[model samples]
Target: MTAHLPVLQVVIPLMAAAVCAALRPARVAWAFAVLVSWTVFVIAVLLLREVLAGGTISYEIGGWAAPWGIEYRIDVVNAFVLLIVSTVGAVVLPYAGDSVEREIRRDQIPLFYTAFLLCLTGLLGITITGDVFNVFVFLEISSLSTYTLVAMGRERGALTAAFRYLVMGSVGATFIVIGIGLLYSVTGTLNMVDLGLRLSELTATRTVPVAFAFLTVGISLKLALFPLHLWLPNAYAYAPSAATAFIAATATKVAVYMLLRFFFTVFGATFSFDTMQLGFVLLPLALVAIFSMSLVAIFQVNVKRMLAYSSLAQIGYITLGISIGTVTGLTAGILHLFNHAMMKAALFMALGCVIYRVGSIRIEAFHGLGKRMPLTMAAFVVAGLSLVGVPLTVGFISKWYLILAVLEQGWWPVAALVLFTSLMALVYIWRVVEAAYFHPSPTDEVAAAVREAPLSLLIPTWILVVVNVYFGVDATLTVEVAGRAAEALLGVPR
Candidate 1:
């Protein structure tokens, strides 16, 4: 069982997703999804522990050898991502029961859970697979399911958002497949390890560099990095709250994982940074995304859309860390990948709670909500504080490392901009806070009607809230894991 954990980690949720659709009563499907998510989460924990205790774990399909048969590989980097994705799924699925009931029709509920599980499976598969082509396969699975999930949103705009995402996503997928195909053309192998060894030897080929460019652009689009991120805000803004929370937390993170995997592992860090100079290209774009998107988030009427824009800015921070092209910088990027997932998921879940009661995530919908939905709003504030990089929160820990990484490079101006962007996060978050706490409700009837979100919703939201703080206060475990993952990717001695 332990030996097969890598395959099992992906197979369970995928097979269960099909079973979920056939289950009677949408609630049963929801319960089954939750069960499968927890199971996957436990498996991820086991996998992470296995990696930490030993080292890399590789499973060959049907006992076939590498570079011939498909392989599922687990290491500190992907194991950390698996933990993040599964952890979010476990927490989000539980919250889905009530939130979905409120937002989706009863008949559509099972379908929603099915799509969620499929998306989860795709993300996990993408993270664990060792084959480059398999990455494209899983990317499609997740992308197709995500489109379905987004289209299930209550608003008509959800369809438009889904369509836009599909168009952009398909183009990105095409580029990725072409990239993979080109690499195979040159190297004659799909296995990442085999490709890496082969690619290191093959030099001065125009094909490899072109393939690298395609993969970079494709991945940048998929990860919603800066200018390529137009699809994200609307997709996140109009999707079902549960979908938004899950997708926001996991999808782009996995895509970024693809970036790290390809740039650092498959291509080798020296070739990617020293030869290709990816850091120079990524650095300016990341800075633009952080400052520009943060400013955009401040003026939004719809809080969900505001947060959606904020996500682009947050992604900028992750890419910034990557662009610094140092082990500490890479560690900060990866660390922020996990931290932002928690903070943003919590914020979106809180919005789900608001939508549960008020049917709106517009800023005005939160008027006087501090009194009406005290716990939910408080959770929002804390998560918002975490987003702002306040001390004793996961957001702070991510920023602390990022700043340290920037300063380590003596990029003083870049470090100051990072700090300035935190203030921008604060300004946007404070806008919501002022409305919720200081302003009066439009009507007493409205105030009377709105009450706290149910415990089912509050529990998961607060679980993440507690995570944001707990990890912030004591970051020993996360930092250690991130550090290990970074060192492994950089081929440094642990």
Candidate 2:
């Protein structure tokens, strides 16, 4: 059982998703999904413990050996990613019952849960698989489910958002497949570890560099990097609240994980860093994304759309950390990977509460949120502070490390930009706070109609908010694990 933990971790949710699809009762399906999500979280925790205790664990699918057969490899880096993804999935599912019921048509509710579980299964599979082809297969599985989930939005425009995301996601997947084909043509293998080994032996090849370029661009689109991120705001803003909370918190983060796996694990440090100097490219784009997206967010009238743009800017921070390309830098990148997920999930879930009572997520609806829905808006404040990178929040820890990472490289200008953009974050976050706390509530039926969101939504929202603060004050766990993951990927024991 212990030996099969790697495959079991993914297979459980995947198989359960099928069962969920088979059952038609939305409530039953939701219950099953909640159980499966928590179970997956436990399995992920167990797998992480085993990996940390025993180093990397390799599980060959169906007892077939690697290089010839499919493999599921577990290491410090991926194990940590698995934990982050699973943690978000588990937290989001319990909150889904209320959010999904409110946003989705009754008949489609069961399918929503089914799609959600399948998406979860796909993300976990992508994180755990050691084969490059397997990554693409799972990417599509997650993506198709994502399209369905987004289309479940109550808004009529949700179909457009879903279609747009489908188009962009398809293009990204196609590029990734083309890249994999090039690598296979050069190395005659599809397994990532084997491909890495073969490439190390081969000198510079036209195909290899082209493959590298292809993978980078494709992953950039998937991770919603900068200009490629146009599809994300719509995908998230128009999705069902539950879907938005889950996807915003997990999907792009997993894509970032895929990028890290390819750059650090598949390409190796010399090729990705020294020869190609990917950081030089990522640095400028990351800076632009940080500032440009932050400015765009400040102007948005819709609160959900505002945070959607903010998520893109946060991704910029993650990429900035990666662009620094040092042990400290990678650690910051990975730490923010988890930190951003926590804070954003909390924020979106808080929005989920507002959308519950009132259908609109516009700024005007929140004019008196602090007074009416005190608990939910308070949760939003804590999470918003975290988003602003305020001290005593998870966002602050991530930025603290990013600053150290930039300063370590003597890039004072970039460091200054980071601090400046963070202040921009405060500006956008404050916009909501002002509307919610300072402005007067509408004096008509609108204010009379809106009430406090149910505990079902508020509890999950606060859980993440509390964790955001708790983890900020005690960075021992997240920092230590992220440091080890970074050290493993960089091959430098720090």
Runs off by more than 4 Å, candidate 2: none
**1-494 per-residue lDDT for model 2 (tens digits):** 77888998889998998899877678889999999999999999999999888899899999889989999999988999899889999999999998888889999888898899999999999999999999999999999999999999988889999999999999999999999999999899989889889998999689988999999999999999998998999889999988899999999999999999999889898899888999999999999999999999999999999999999999999999998888999999999999999999999999999999977889888898889989999999999999999999999999999999999999999999999988998998898899999998888996778899998888889999999999999999999999999999888854
CA lDDT scores, all candidates in order? 0.95, 0.93
Worst 10 residues of 2 by lDDT: 485-494
lDDT of 1: 0.95
- Model 1 clash pairs are none
- Cα RMSD to native, each candidate? 0.7, 0.9
Query: Candidate 1: which stretches are off by over 4 Å?
Result: none
Give, for candidate 1, the lowest lDDT window spanning 10 residues.
440-449
lDDT of 2: 0.93
Tell me the lDDT of model 2 at 392.
95
